[model samples]
Target: MERFFTLLLILVLSCGLAQAQQKHSISGKVTDNTGEALTGANVYINGTTIGTATNAKGEFTLKNITAGNYQICASFSGFKRYRENIELNASIQNLEMSMEESTGTLGEVVVTGTGTPHHLKTAPVPTELLNSQMIESAAAPDFINLMGSVSPSFDFSPNTMGSFMQLNGLGNDFIVILIDGRRVYGDMGGMNDLGRINPNNIERVEVVKGASSALYGSDAIAGVINIITKKSKRSISANHNTQYGTYNTYQSTTNIDFNSKIVSGHTTFSQSKTDGWQNSPYEVDGDELVETDEMTQNAYLRRNVRQDLEFRISDKLSIYGGGSYYMNDNKRALSVKDYGLFFEDFSYNAGAKYLLSKSSNITFDYTSDTYKYYYKYNQTKEGKYEAGDYQLNSDQRRDDYNLRWISKLGKHQTITLGSELVQEFYRSEGRLQHDEESVNTLSFYLQDEISLFDDLMLTAGLRVVKHDNFGTIATPKLSALYQLGHFNLRGTYSRGFKAPTLKEQYYYYEKRGTLYLGNTDLDPQKSNYYSAGVDYNNKWLSTNMSVYQNDVDGLIAYENTELLPGDADNGIKKRRQHFNIEEARTRGFDVMVDVKLPLGFSFGGGYSYVDAMNLTEDIRLDYVARHYGNVRVGYFHHWNNYHLNVQLLGRLQDDKYYHEEPNAKGYDLWKLTTTHQLLHSNKVNLKLTAGIDNVFDYVDDVPYGENRGTINPGRTYFVGVNINFAN
Candidate 1:
């Protein structure tokens, strides 16, 4: 009988051990107050070394946990401290928790097109995030002109022909532009001016400086700009926006949404017009105009419409699509020449997503965009010009498709696979024209997140791209994060590559009667980047500081063209030819701090320092100001009749170069915004913003053309009002 009892006891203990093993492990996600995924969050049990940091996917898994009732704590920066009691059961497997953003928290999470979302506190890379609230508060004319109020790094020059904003000292071709993870290339005269993009449709803008070809591929040697669109939520009913300011500038924006069990969608439209500033009598310091040169005040006009649709086919399958159409008319000015230019573009995007299982999913998306350009001009100088009253037209179209899959392969590993293909077609009729050149691109990437221990997470990713002109290239990235109590430290190293653009390969233009030739022998540009940062976050405050460096090779330079219509071989009035430069580098530092003070009040600010220059020329690149920063203070109050809020903005920027010029003096600006809630029955709201750009009215002698200059607009004021209604 005793022997039998002993055997029974052994069996019971064995079963208990198995049960404990099962009960101790818990896996799931932690979300923010807004239902958005919270990444790099920490979850832990009291008085134990057992803890795990959230993955890039915002998931966490705890293993070998003791079976018992325990207190769990979830902590993140710029958020309220979250703690809860969790009961462990023999059959329990996973638990999910939601954390709220601290009341009056100013700095929020930023997404910078790394295919992932990260908070400012723990993110290893230097990036800037701007939300709709900030955009609306600035109240700039268009998306590009808003540059003066938002980021100080990028200097914007308003042109009648298009919205002109240059990144750093790099030309427009060097910048990579994206909308919701998809590339959007729009250019005129070799420059993809930012003025063409409408601000009304933008939900957020993420900017990353320096070489980012590692993740986005080519056209990112200068920087990366990702524009995220607005989505319709069941809670949001309708919104209308309008603004009228100087220069006959008027803007109208509207959004409407409807939701059903099986279908939901939103439609948005915006239109704007500007009489534009004076361009004639344009000279250095606005002094005098030279003979045989004439400038005329031009106008800028645009019309845009966008639609978003979401359809739920089943519990596990869904479809989302968006389409947009943009039309713009502007004028360009050059010595002895003034031309009216028109740009029209239409784009369509469709995507389908499926949940393969509880832990895996797949998505596919396709996009097509076509651009049409028309130009009309007459020479200002007296000459027997051919093609008098000329009109030139051109068309360029692009198609892109991508497929991606994500999987959670157990508690220790996560995987992602994606493939993309892009095709381009170009045709034009003008003095400088090109036949259709189709570029075929294929890219594949794999990313994995490995959990080494309780407090350590390692992420590794590799991407390979094949281009018809550049052959094949590989980019790899590795990052590690370590959690030490309330502080987190992380480091990353990545490789970036950029292929030559069609303009660099086939474009032919004459500069001052000199013919320039395209180089089919140009090689791709490559770069290696490294970054390290430390972050601290608790209930009251969150802060981060990071330093980064980019080493680049095979950089492109312009050489005089050998062949010209008038071949004097004097080496003057020569067109530009593309050739590889030896080396170049960009280094920068970023620091951000956010404090959630008492009584629904908060303060947040960030500072960035960038030294981006050309090694070959030994001069700074133009338009990239060395220093930039933004500061904010806001307060919120809830009332039975209505909710009220007030905020202030302080923006600063250092002087920068204009391509090859020396530098422009930096300036500071200030702005204020307020909102009030009303209507107890209908859900009505109103918001107002007052901004003073260039608070000091500082004038800048902006360089233009070969050796000419003009003064940027003086101080300006903006006022905007937005209304929302729901039933």
Candidate 2:
């Protein structure tokens, strides 16, 4: 493996050096119709790979371009595409372009569904996009809540295990989460620690539904969510944001960036703390309500730091690296003694890219993530509790390496080829009797996109994976899109597969009077997914509707077995084991509509319906809701040099069904937020925000351990301030 990588590196460097000697460069600036600078606008040569984005001053430079005649274009979201003809010579060429704002969604660009960039209206596969405007308007504290509030197909609920997340009736174990194209690893009781993400640093979020194993592998059976972070192109820039809310909740973040001709660096530091609240002070024991012995919600504190740097070694070669550290401390309140749950994570990544020419490139990246969980027991001395640590519960480590090559074959075709290697190691003193266990996976994939005609596009992809325990598996996907005037129709079919994790196959534990055991002979799960959708866009309105069905085989779940005769006298000792004994199906439909009304007003809403069932037992799936929806309204006004905006958001859900407990009732929630731009200047900007959540002060006081319709802590108010400076 080492020799192979060494040889590839040598080949890439040689090609880059040869190409560097005979290339020219292009420089330009992009602006709006009013001659105002437009930052982050993309400027590229048509039908080629040479491209770059405009800086803070709306200036861009595309280096290492071969001398030729090409069509140069500039594109930005909510703006018309600008094109110009140019001829490159031995010297650098400079130009300027202007664009006009549009009221349609056709200008948006998406990259998550296909692993290649394309306009949202022309993408063969369906994709959902949420920009910074929507994210900020919602004023959500974390990623899970942000998604749940904006998307009808997504749902979240707080629990003792963690925050339970479901997408189209599928659980978190089947979903894949990515940050800037890299996967985020670490889960506590089947839930990922979404708090580690810095919400203020996000630029956008993209969602792709149905199976995506052909491009990402394994756990992408349910869907994929990719988060893109903010980037600055100024010489130096800094931002500070702070928020204070009810229940002693606080959040603050600081970001700094420095960019030069050849080197750029970015850093972020953030902290969040919340004194959690309980809606109920009672518990249900069979048929009676009793006083609660423990707090329903636990308080938590989190701190995180991240840094990234990039070096442009000539125009044809660039190297980048980054690392992050995050820690969380959770406190539980009990009548007897309070216990603590602590978590720590450390991650590092590095990557390099080599541009083969104007239309091709090869890149390599590596990442390592380590996560640790600890339990602390407070000791009682005299009349007070002292801080004392107890045991290390679990430790997990993951390493990944990827190499990819992308090229434009001709005017109407593009190709992508990639390979990935992943390694995982886990140890748990409470669940596993052994010291540790590990698993490895290797995958290779190929994808092709063809522009069959002016109004038709087709995409095909395939992936082959080899796992240490599951042997070999194959996944395939096909999609097509047809555009007619202002409407687009798209369809897709895909296959997905998932291998059992090491912990799921070897761990054993006892909880709440029940013993659970894992089976080493478990079979891998597989699924077939089908989807169809239509999109309509015009100057004033945009609408989309999609329907999907997923059929899964050999699903893994815990089943109750007979109790041992020797333990019958002690109590009702039930035994549970993981088995692949059930087949399941989930079908859903999603509809969304947005209209831009007159007088700086906009209205939008969405609805989702899901039917999840266990075919083997003819029963409804647990934690799945049949119907859910959201509505949003906003008004924006600008006077003189100040801007003001107001937004109202509401969410409603139908009853949720479960097999082992009572059904959860339906509920409604509402929120109102107002933002004011106090100052806007050439070098600095300041903004303030205030909001009220759960405006009606509605609360569900259901007892602990039972399903609750809503977990909101009634009416809450918050205030926030943001400051930015650039030079």
Count: clashes, candidate 2:
0
lDDT of each residue in 599-653, candidate 2, tens digit only: 9999988999999988899988788889999898999998966888899988889
After the best TM-score superposition of candidate 1, give how far the Cα of residue 700 lies from its true spot, in angstroms: 2.2
- Assess the local accuracy of residue 547 in candidate 1 as a C-alpha lDDT between 0 and 100: 82
| Residue pairs in collision within model 1 | 160-331, 161-331, 163-195, 168-624, 169-622, 214-496, 280-295, 622-657, 623-657
| Candidate 1 weakest lDDT stretch, 10 residues | 12-21
Clashes of 1: 9
Write the residue-wise lDDT of candidate 1 on 141-206 in tens digits.
677655555564565544444434555445466677887777776677665645545676577788
Query: lDDT values of the candidates?
Result: 0.65, 0.81
Candidate 1, residue 464: how far the Cα is off, in Å: 0.9
